[model samples]
Target: MADGVPMVATLAAKTMEVPGVHTLSLALDTHSPFDFDYGQFNMLYLFGAGEVAISIMGWHQGLLQHTIRAVGRVTRPLVALEVGQQLGLRGPFGRGWPLAQLRGRDLVFITAGLGCAPVVAAIHHAVANRDQYGRIVILQGVKHHADLLWQTQYRRWQALGECQVLLAASEEHRHRHHWRLGLVTELLALAEFDADHCAVMMCGPEIMMLAALKQLARLKVADEAVYMSLERNFQCGRGLCGHCQLGPYFVCKDGPVFHYPQVKPWLGREGV
Candidate 1:
């Protein structure tokens, strides 16, 4: 199949993660295998409703998984889809995390809100191949404790004894013994990783990632050692549409994932 053409896929399963958020498992109609790297996204089409760019969460039993927040025209309907319903899928697009290059080094994952979807698969890969890496530190932040998706997965990773998982709720007045009541960046102080020898993967709102870059710099983490997954108006999965451009690059083509140094100039800019 061509990259631009949408392929038929059936909704095999749906798991509600939180209010307005769902994990959809789609089984492609083709018999051939479908593979995608962590951090890549796919354009899911709903026939008349249009399409939206969603990050690939991973795969299970040959089913493609995407965690979507029902906040838009296409996404709202996509999440509401019932099992056995069919949709169109185009691509396992964009660049992905450099997990191969960072082998033997510590991994520090920083994410906020629903942006964690793009990095979740990478974390799972690291955990499954634990001996190949140094330390695994996961930090996530949400507006409320209940807003934290995959709460059970985070707890399971924490129980691994080697992985460090820290969560922060910025708007919560009440405290849970397992959660810190502050910004996710605050949890960085308590996270254990070698800043100089670790690779950092970050996703979320532009403001949040920018703030994290500053914190990482203070800890002597080189800009080259960090990578980020960026979001933009990806109307088309290909760069020809120009909807997802950032300076000379297109988020849908050049990257949804890029090394920190590659996008430093436009990170927090008002307009690109």
Candidate 2:
């Protein structure tokens, strides 16, 4: 398929990660494999409901996977799709994490809510090739314990020799042994990573990312060392539509993942 053209994809499998969220495994109609980078997104189009920009969860058994929360017009029907149903897919768009540049550096991953989906593949890649990186620090925040998706996966990462995983639940009343009750940013203090030689990748509500950025700066991490994956109302998948614009760059084309300094001027600013 040509760039920007939607290709037919069959629903291969669907797993419910949480109550309203699901991971959809889609098999493209094309014979060639569908390749995408960590932090890239694809436009999933339903026949009548329209398309929505969903982050590529990862590739599994040659199928493209996407974790979607059914909170919008396209996503609600997308989660309801049965196996064998078909949907339109338009790309593995936008820039991804600069893993090449990050090699040999300690990696710090910070995410809140469902934002982890975009960075999950990168984490997996780093873990799979652990020798290429230094220590791995993973920090996540959720409203409650039950809201934490991929709990088992986090545990597996935690068990790794050089990996540190910290989870926080902001609204939980009862204490969980493995989780702390506070904002995700609070866990930053306990994360084990070399601030001077670590690459920080963060995604979440803008407020949370902003907070994390401030904390990272206080810890002496350079703005150049931090990267962020931003979410926006992406209408066109390409930069033609201005819905996903940030400052002078388009989130869909220039980046869904960007160096902190690239977007610093417009981040958290109102009416951008």
What are the lDDT figures for the candidates, one per model? Answer: 0.92, 0.92
Which residue segments of model 1 deviate by more than 4 Å?
A: 173-177
How big is the positional error of residue 190 in model 2, measured in Å on the Cα after superposition? 0.8
Each candidate's TM vs. the true structure?
0.98, 0.98
Residue 157 deviation, candidate 1, in Å? 0.4
The per-residue C-alpha lDDT of model 1 at residue 179 equals 84
Please, what are the lDDT tens digits per residue for candidate 1 over residues 1-272?
A: 79889999999999999989999999999988888899999999999899999999999899999999999789999998999999999998999999999999999999999989999999999999999999999999999889989988998998997799889999982365558998888888888999889999999998888888888889889999999999999888888899988988999999999998999988777878
Q: Which stretches of candidate 2 lie over 4 Å from their true place?
A: 173-177
